[model samples]
Structures are given as structure tokens and as C-alpha cells.
Target: MSDAAAYACDNVSTPVEAVQAVLARDDLTPAQKQEIAQGFSARGLEFDVSEQVCVDQG
Candidate 1:
């Protein structure tokens, strides 16, 4: 694995943070954003969507 991946794998227990980081970036497509949002919703956590819970940068 790449160094970054290796380090994250060893350190970050919650991969959702990394996924959310990617989602926040403008590089992700709308479909990707939707998928991430849905996945987060499915986790049964109370999400403050207006608080930029995941893909929302605005």
C-alpha cells in the first residue's frame, strides 16, 4: 500500500473521517456525494446536514 494509506490504516480507526474528507473536497462528483450522504444516513446517527455532515462544503 502507499505510505499514506499504510499510515491511515495503522492510525485511523474511523475510516468515515477519511471518506468525509474526500467528500468535502470538490473533486468528488455529485453522485459520489449522494452516495456518501446516504451511507451516513444509513448509519442511524443524527446528522446535522446543515452543519456540513460529510459531503456538504457549503
Candidate 2:
């Protein structure tokens, strides 16, 4: 999913908050979780939760 959507899923803000959400999840693998963690290690990144984005109908 998009970064905003991922953050929205857990109602979080900032990379640290995003990582905390990832750690709390149970549907992903260690490597997948690690990759997400790495992505958040630096700034300017959009998380890849892989969930479908909800586009506007209007």
C-alpha cells in the first residue's frame, strides 16, 4: 500500500511510528519486515505495505 495508507492503517505518523506499526503486525515475514525497517532507516521514503490503494470514485 501507499505510505500514507500504511500509516493510516495503524493511525501513525513519522517513520518511527511506521516502524512501530510494522513490528506489531503478524502477517509479514521477518525479511519483509526488515526491508520495511530499512526503508524507514532514512528519510524520504514511502512504505510498501502491498495492500490495494483506495482510489476516489469522484
- Best model per lDDT: 2
lDDT of 2 by residue, 1-58 (tens): 9988887656545556757787568788767877876667655545544443478999
Model 2 ranges with Cα > 4 A deviation = 1-13, 43-58
**Estimated TM-score per prediction?**
0.35, 0.43
Please identify model 1 stretches exceeding 4 Å from their true place.
1-13, 46-58
Worst 10 residues of 2 by lDDT: 44-53
lDDT of 1: 0.60
